[model samples]
Structure formats: structure tokens, C-alpha cells
Target: MAASGHTGFKRIVKAAGYSWHGLCSTFRHESAFRQELAVSAVLVPLALWLGDDAASRALMIGSVFLVLIVELLNSAVEAAIDRFGGERHQLSARAKDMGSAAVLVSILNAAVIWLLLLI
Candidate 1:
């Protein structure tokens, strides 16, 4: 397999470190991420308490996490767009708009999931 660069526990640790770094960077640079994180902090615990069963809990929790994931992706897209420069361009605007739309959809998904699970 040509070593695959990293192996076993080392690969897991490295992946974890990268994931932590990404989370920190996203939290530091993105206000939207921070807001979502704050909301997740509250909702995740509530989801566990409010859910009637394991599957309901997972659905509620997963939906909230999905928002965080989408927000991170959107932040990444916006960062890449900014990296290209400050100049205005149609493509860059479109990319940013699309990333924003993805976040909105994820938020809506979370809302629907919570509502369905609760009622």
C-alpha cells in the first residue's frame, strides 16, 4: 500500500489534530460559526433530554451538527474566495452566495428535524 504516509494510530492522531485546528480556525474567523456553536451547545443537550428514544436523539443531535458542518464548509468557501483577492467578480460572488445558500438549507433542515421529532 506504499505506507500511505501515516499508519494506524498515527494517522488517527494526525487526522484529529487537523480536525481540531480546523474547528479552532473556523471558530476564530467566522462569527456565524461562533453563533451556531453557541446554539448547538444549548440544543445538543436539550435534544438528548427531549428525545423519546435513541433514534430520535440521534436525529435531533445530527441535525444540529449538520448545521455546524455546513457552516464550516461555507466559511471555507468564503475564505478561498477572499484568497483570490479583494477585486469583485461574478464567479466569486456566485460561489459565496451558493455557500450561504447551503448554510440556509442546513439550518432549515435542522429546524424541520427538531419540529418533527418534538411533535
Candidate 2:
């Protein structure tokens, strides 16, 4: 028989798989998500190109990952807003815009960190 933890392990894997699928779907439907993801996809490999040392590598990679994380959170907020009926409530607008702004700030943060660390 399978191990006792097999069921839980399978469930965790399925949930992670679903999350990745959702991220793909979200990237397709959400233009901003797609743009940020494209930026991040480029930045990761570029980091290894530019980052010749461990500290610079950490700075570059960490900053790029932060942008991705923020983008995912922004996508989550957008999905939440739409799921609630895509209403034009002021708070909803603020929430979504703030999420986007957070992403903007994250991009800026990456740039700043790169400048500080690499140049």
C-alpha cells in the first residue's frame, strides 16, 4: 500500500499544479500580468549574465522574483475584484489600482536595487 502521507502529498501537488495553471490563465487574460511576467522571464537569465558574483546574483534574482510575487498578488486582487461581479465600486477600483501601483513600485525597486548593487 502507499505511504500514509501519500494522499496529502498528492493533494499538495494538485493544489500547486492548479495554482500554476491559474497563473497561466491569468497571464493570458491579464495584459499587465503578461507584461510583468515577460519582463521577469527576461530578467532572470539576464541576471546571470550581468551578475558575476554571489551578492550581485542574489540582488538581481531576488529583485526579479519580488516583481513576480507582486504581480501574482496584483493578479489575485484583480481576480478577486472580477469574481465579486466587476462592479465599479470606488473601493474596488482603489484596490485594483493600488495593486497595480504596488507592481510599479516593485519594478522601480528592482531597478534601484540593480543600480545600487551592479553600478
Candidate 3:
């Protein structure tokens, strides 16, 4: 057998489980994460309902997930920024703001995707 740490599909499953745990930890600790998760729950099912065709379904579902993914990344960045210091700094603030901007862009993307699909 190969010496890779991940033996096979089991490794993928284990990694995914680990990832889920991490996401859960963020959800519990981060208010923004919790909010995003709540939004995703509603949006995902609604997207499924709105998706009358294959392309629409994929677009809606994919866009919702993209927002969630971006939120997670933004939360991670904010955490890292907080860890760097409690003191105020221009660079740190900019970093957090940029991460926030990224998330906002992703949300807009999701909105556009849904709107276009529905049309």
C-alpha cells in the first residue's frame, strides 16, 4: 500500500468529518457563522423548491453553498486577525474588512445567480 497518510475513500470521509467538526466549532463560537448557517438552511431548501429545472437547481444550490463557504472563510480570517492582537491596527482592520468584502461579493453572486435562474 502507498505510504500516503490517507489510505483511500476512508481518508476522504475522515477528512470531511474533521472539516464538519471544525465548521461546527466555528458555528458555535462565531455569531456570524451561526447567522450564515441559519440563512443557508432556509435558502438551500427554498432553492430546491425554486429550481424547476436541472440548471436552475444546480445554480441555486451551488450559489447558496458558495455563500456558506465564503462565510466560513471570512470567519476564519477574522479569527486569525483577532488572534494577531487585541490592539487596533490599520493593517489588521483592513484585512478583516477585505475578508468581509469577499463574503459580501459572494452573497451578491448568490443573489445574481438566483435572480438569473428564476428569470
Q: How would you encode candidate 2's per-residue C-alpha lDDT over 12-67 as one tens digit per residue? A: 78779889898888878888778777887898898888888988888899998898
- Model 2 has an lDDT value of 0.86
* Stretches of model 1 off by over 4 angstroms after superposition: 1-4
lDDT by residue (tens digit), candidate 1, 74-111 = 99999999998999999999999999999999999999
- TM per candidate: 0.93, 0.84, 0.84
On the 0 to 100 scale, the lDDT of residue 43 in model 3 is: 87
Pitting candidate 1 against candidate 2, the one with the higher TM-score is 1
- Cα lDDT tens digits, model 3, 1-119, are 44657778978888799898988888888887788778889988898888898888888888888888888888888888898779999999998899899989998999999888888
lDDT of each: 0.95, 0.86, 0.86
Clashes of each: 0, 0, 0
TM-score of the candidate numbered 2?
0.84
